[model samples]
Target: MKFERLPFIMKNLIRYQATMKENDWNKGFDLLRSIEFQEGVYKTGPMFFSMEPAENEPRYRNFEFFMPVNFQVEGE
Candidate 1:
């Protein structure tokens, strides 16, 4: 395996969050892609995703998906 360290830079992000059933990860990416295409936003870097146990639902997970963009996104 190969590993490389990346530096942190402050940038705009288009994010989506939801509590979803286990293994439903791809949907967030699809949603973000749709938003990107519709908004004509330039993607500045790689997408980022994180998951944790849902706060109130044990069988589901809280997922956060972030896409770094060149311009600020207007909505939440």
Candidate 2:
């Protein structure tokens, strides 16, 4: 499994990272909206998770939905 830290709702808050197969992209988005989360501050464009190219790794040349969210947390 892959693991990485998702952005926080605010400073010093819990964060989660998840991925969906993307059958219905809106479903994933709707689920996020139904949860207690907030929008993260970022440049208004595609944010690539880039690294030095590897012969065994594939590149993501396109994305239909790319967003970052933070779960609302009451404590640090």
Candidate 3:
């Protein structure tokens, strides 16, 4: 993640968790709805893994600016 986006991500995470703690189900859902978790693609062979924003969700499309390049090392 980029340094600039880190704060926003962290703040959202904390707020989301806090809402959950306060039994604010609606707010928590809203927070989750606004946040997007995207999967990162590593260009090493055919390996794949789950990403945060989910494939179809677009709330995080703006945050796509923070997508990291897939760097792979030899032998896992």
Candidate 4:
């Protein structure tokens, strides 16, 4: 198999982090949308998601969700 590396592009994003089990993975996303709605923010690009084993809780994972916005949000 062959693969090519893609260059990293810098982006401004609103980030939300949470720890939860796989069954509740969408919770973070829902919360992020709620915040976006409350703040009148719109997504400008794809949503980014990352996860790793939660500290001291093997059943859960620490997740970070990122939403790229059209412009930088103040007081972030």
Which candidate number has the best lDDT? Answer: 1
Show model 3 residue runs off by greater than 4 Å.
1-15, 19-23, 37-76
TM-score of 4: 0.79
Model number with the top TM-score = 1
| Candidate 2 lDDT, 15-70, residue by residue in tens | 32333332433453454344433444332233222123334435412223334433
lDDT of each: 0.88, 0.36, 0.27, 0.81
Model 1, span 1-76: residue lDDT tens = 9998999775898889988987888999989988888898878899989999988899999999999987988995
Candidate 4 — which residues are off by over 4 angstroms? 1-3
Q: How many residue pairs clash in each candidate?
A: 0, 0, 6, 0
How does each model score on TM-score?
A: 0.82, 0.25, 0.21, 0.79
Looking at model 1, residue 72 earns an lDDT score of: 88
What would you estimate as the lDDT of candidate 4? 0.81
For TM-score, candidate 1 versus 2, the one ahead is 1
Specify the poorest-scoring 10-residue window by lDDT in model 4.
67-76
Query: Is candidate 1 or 4 superior in lDDT?
Result: 1
Across 1-76, the per-residue lDDT of candidate 4 in tens digits comes to 9999999564668888888896788888887788777778888878778999998998999999888876777755
